[model samples]
Target: MKIAVIGAGSWGTALSTVLADNNHDVVLWTRREEQAREINEERSNYKYLPGFTVPESIRATDSFAECVENTHVILLVVPTKAIRETVQRLLPFIGEDTTLIHASKGIEPGTSKRISEMIEEELGDKKVQSIVVLSGPSHAEEVCKRKPTTVTVSSETEEAAERVQELFMNEQFRVYTNHDLIGVEIGGALKNIIALGIGMNDGLGYGDNAKAALMTRGLAEIARLGVKLGANPLTFKGLSGLGDLIVTCTSQHSRNWRAGFKLGTGYELEDVLEEMGMVVEGVRTTKAVHELAKRLQVDMPITEALYDVLFNGKKPPEAAKQLMGRVRKNEEELASLFLGTGDSDRS
Candidate 1:
């Protein structure tokens, strides 16, 4: 199959390698012509995946038309903020019968729309056979090295989900299919926000107990919001939810965690972003989730605190204290919090 991977970032390049390893003809799309030339000429994308040699079969192109033209699948892996613009630009080239897959994990700011929702809105008259989401705890640095990795693929249709599962499955790379697109997407996007919070915890010289607490309570809030948005509560325990959260919060490879780590150490958000050299999704996701929580009336204390720190100039230490000082709850109230029973105190 001919596959087009839109956005040649670390994750996109890694997936392109996986498809190329599967012996599929892959076209990697990047905005920079120079990066395309480098991939074709050097067989290496040093900016995103340095020291990793791209497969000879996996080629790069700057032309959106060339990328999507005659492709069997289109993988959207751009940043959350760029999803609308990228899809709008690619709509002209996208075929009516193509399958759309997005591996990007983020919620749109202001609008608070998921990536797939954004895609459907931007698709216009172009009707696709299916829309799939590929997500998990796997990091690009490990994936590019062919390290053992497992991820879940989800879609509205079983056949379409299975097709995507077959497309990327291999010995080193494993894929699972799920029917809950809402659960999968919500898990993938919201975990980044928690990861950022834990990163801030680590930056503030906090210990494991604090991080473990944050992880536990953070997941409670994630499921709270996800359930309010119609996702299955059990999905939070799966690879995309709990799994992605662990990896993103613990690993140095995570840009979101790294960004939060910098912020935790007293650096401003803008300075942290400028130094990262790549998009740290959690910052924007924090804002989006905060707003969504308010609009939906979901109790997301961690998200709210992170938003305060990121956008409203709340210092990290103060934010931590504020979170720790919230009204205590009994086990029943805690159950209500995670279970979304609406019996807990809303104050």
Candidate 2:
């Protein structure tokens, strides 16, 4: 199959390699001409995936039309913030029958829209109809090395999902299929916010017990928000939610985790972001989740605490104290989510 991977970032390049390794003709598109030249000429992306060589069959191009012209499957690997612009630009290039697989992980801040929505906005009601989300706990660092990793591809269209499952699922890369698009998307988006708070806790010198509590509570908050948005609560326990949270919180390879680690170690937000030299999806997701909780009226105490620490000038340890001092309630109290979102599920 001919595969087109948009975005020259680590994840994009890694997935392109997977396709190429499988003997699929792959064209990776980079917005920057220099990055495209490096991929096509030098056979490497030292700036993004250092120590990784581009496969000879995995070519690069700056031309979006050429990349998507005859492609069988396309992977949208750009940052969440760039999803709108990228898809809008790719509209004219999309074949009417093209099947899309979005690997971007984010929810739009104010609109609370996922990347798939961005795609739909661009494509409108075109006859070409396959859409799938591919996400998991796997880091690009591990995936680039062909380490064992598992992820899921979800689409309302089951045949499309299974087609993608057959495309990328190898011995080292396991793929699961699901029909819950909303659940998979929300699960992938919210975990990053928890990762930021986890980083802050580590910076405050919190022990494993505190980290575990934060994770447990964060998962609940994530599930609450997801359920309100019409997502299946079970998705939160799957690879895209709990699995992603664990990896993002604990893995040193995670930019969100490292960004949080720096903030936890007392660096200012600007300095930490500047030094990290990568997109920390969690920081942006944190702001969005805070607004979402208010809009939905969910009792997301951990999200609130983290938001205070991230935006309201609260110290990490102080934020911890605030959480500990809050009037505790039944862990299964479902009334909080019921208030605004009108979700019928009991806590």
Tens-place lDDT digits, model 2, residues 1-347: 78889988999998887777778889999888999999888998997788987888988989998888876578899988998888777677676678889998888889877778877877776646688999989888788889999999999889989999989988889999978899899889888888888888887888799899889878878888788788877787889988988998898888887887888888888898898788888878888878877887777888788788778888777888998897755655344442434343332
**Candidate 1, residues 59-168: lDDT per residue as tens digits?**
89999999988876999999989988988887776675889999999999889999999999988778888899999999999999999999999999999999999999
RMSD of candidate 1 to the true fold?
1.7
Q: Which candidate is the best by TM-score?
A: 1
Prediction 1 TM-score vs. true: 0.96
- lDDT (Cα) of model 1: 0.89
lDDT comparing candidate 2 with the true structure: 0.83
Q: What TM-score does each of the candidates earn?
A: 0.96, 0.93
Stretches of candidate 1 exceeding 4 Å from the true structure:
331-347
